[model samples]
Target chain A: MRARLLEATVELLVEKGFSGTTTTLVSERAGVSRGAQLHHFPTKNDLVVAAVAHLTERRGEELAERAAELPTGSQRTRAVIQMLGDHFAGPVFTAALELWVAARTDAALLEAVAPLERVLGRETHVMTVELLGADESQPGVRELIQATLDLVRGLGLASTLGDDTRRRRKILDQWALTLDVALDKEKQ
Target chain B: MRARLLEATVELLVEKGFSGTTTTLVSERAGVSRGAQLHHFPTKNDLVVAAVAHLTERRGEELAERAAELPTGSQRTRAVIQMLGDHFAGPVFTAALELWVAARTDAALLEAVAPLERVLGRETHVMTVELLGADESQPGVRELIQATLDLVRGLGLASTLGDDTRRRRKILDQWALTLDVALDKEKQ
Candidate 1:
């Protein structure tokens, strides 16, 4: 029942944003009783924060599995970029985007969501580092890895409104080449 | 009166987001009456869209002026990154973020905002190209300029929730170096 409610929350958030996802609406969508929802989550914040954390952890694991399959080299870098591009354009990102906007004005939401964002950011950053086989201790290498993440995140945000896949692909290609050059220089 | 209402709308957006920025609140903040507000904007869509367009144009001009003042070479590239970082963390971007989130679920708002976003995106891309003093006619050069924008935009989005300025600066520095090397290689 709790899982169903959380799933409903994610769906409603992606379809209708923070303001539109009322407790009643979520209960209705989940086919869970209003009493059961309150029993599971006393407040909307509890419900939303749990839903995001659950979704993010699942997405993170999926990305890790995908990253583990790629061969090391520029090919892997391109694949990782593609993976992130797809992640950002999906429901997980949409749900997160809605939360970020709502949290901008709602201190309570921000308080609940900020730590979760940090955990997700840190976990993803570590995943990217491992996927690229980057030496984070090296001068400037860590920052470059982060820049790659930042670039992908921005592209993903743009993709939310329109089909930025072609342009995003171009960016990933160019950035992959640049990363190859940077990594080579670092080794020397 | 129109300009004041627009200004109030932007302020409210950055502070309260779309659902929070009611017509009554905007009228009160703008020091205009409900009748005048209605006369000027028949619907909330008209009011919010005009505010974003106005803010985007003003920001575009500010960025152009800033870009024109930078000395050519790697210095200009770094400055442009800094400029974009600041721009993304500002009120204008905040207001735009609200609109984007709201528009995601509201088809009417999406119809109103999509074109303005494209215009702002194009103008910013052109400004970055000019700032880099890059040959847009070249194959990879144009994409590199775009990657820079995408990177900064990503950084800016992250910075909204936390103090990412230090990491953002580090990314800017590394990316600027990578860009310089890429451009140099292209020339040779």
Candidate 2:
């Protein structure tokens, strides 16, 4: 019941945004009784914060599992960046974005979401480093990795407005080349 | 009265977000008569969309004015990227972000905002190329500029969570170097 409610909350968040999502709607979508929903999460803030944290953790674990399957050597840099691009452009990121915008103005939500976001961000950074076999000891490498993440995120933002895949693919390929140079890896 | 209402609309948007903002609050904040607000914009969608368009145009003009003052040669790339970072992190961007998220689920809002957003996006892209003195005739240069914009916008999103300035500056500086290499320009 708890898992179903959380999944429903995320789906509603993606469909209706944070402002439009309600506990009532979540309960209805989850097909869980109102009593059970209240018993679990008493407030909208409590439910949403829980749902986002739950979904983000699931997404992160999925990313970790996928990371294990990435190809090594020349193709790895592009593959890693593309994986991130796909991750950010997916539904989980969309749901998180709604909460992020709402959290900007809602102090309580901001407090709840901030630390969780920071931890997720750090995990992503660490994962990118491992997947790329990147040496963060080098100058500008850490910042470069961060920029790559930011670039893909921004691309995800663009994709929200429309289908930006063709252009996005080109941009990602170019960034891969740039990353290869910055990391001093041999070109494919 | 219309200008005051539009200004108030943007201010409320930055403070309260789309779902929280209403015509009543806008009129109240603008000190305009409720009747006058209706005379101008009949619906919440009309008012908010007009406000975003008004503010984005003003912001773009301001960017153009600022672009004239940028230094030439080595400092320009970093300066340009910084200027864009400031633009995306400011209040107007925040107001626009609220609408963008709202528009994702609201078909009426999306239809209204899509074309306007496309126009604004093109203008920003053209301006960035001019400011960077980038030659798009070069294979990857255009995508590189787009990636730069996306990076800063993503950085702006990160800033909504907190003051990410120190890290943002480092990332921008690093991107400046990468862009320099991609553009085949002199190192700063």
User: Residues A1-188, candidate 1, lDDT per residue (tens digit)?
Assistant: 98899999999999888999999999999999999999999999999999989888888888878877876643777777778778887899989988988887899999999988888888888887877778888889999988888888888788888846788888888888888788773332
Which residue runs of candidate 1 sit more than 4 Å off their true CA positions? A185-188, B185-188
Per-residue CA lDDT of candidate 1, range B1-188, in tens? Answer: 99999999999998888999999999999999999999999999999999999988888788878867877643766776788888987889889888988998999999999988888888888877766667877778888988888887787778777755777888889888888888763332
- Runs in model 2 lying further than 4 Å from the true structure: A186-188, B186-188
Residue-level error in angstroms, candidate 2, position B88 = 0.6
How many collisions per candidate? Answer: 0, 0
Which digits, one per residue and each the tens of the lDDT, describe model 2 over residues B22-90?
A: 899999999999998999999999999999999998998899899999999789998999999999889
**lDDT accuracy of residue B139 in candidate 2:** 92
lDDT of each: 0.85, 0.90
Candidate topping lDDT:
2
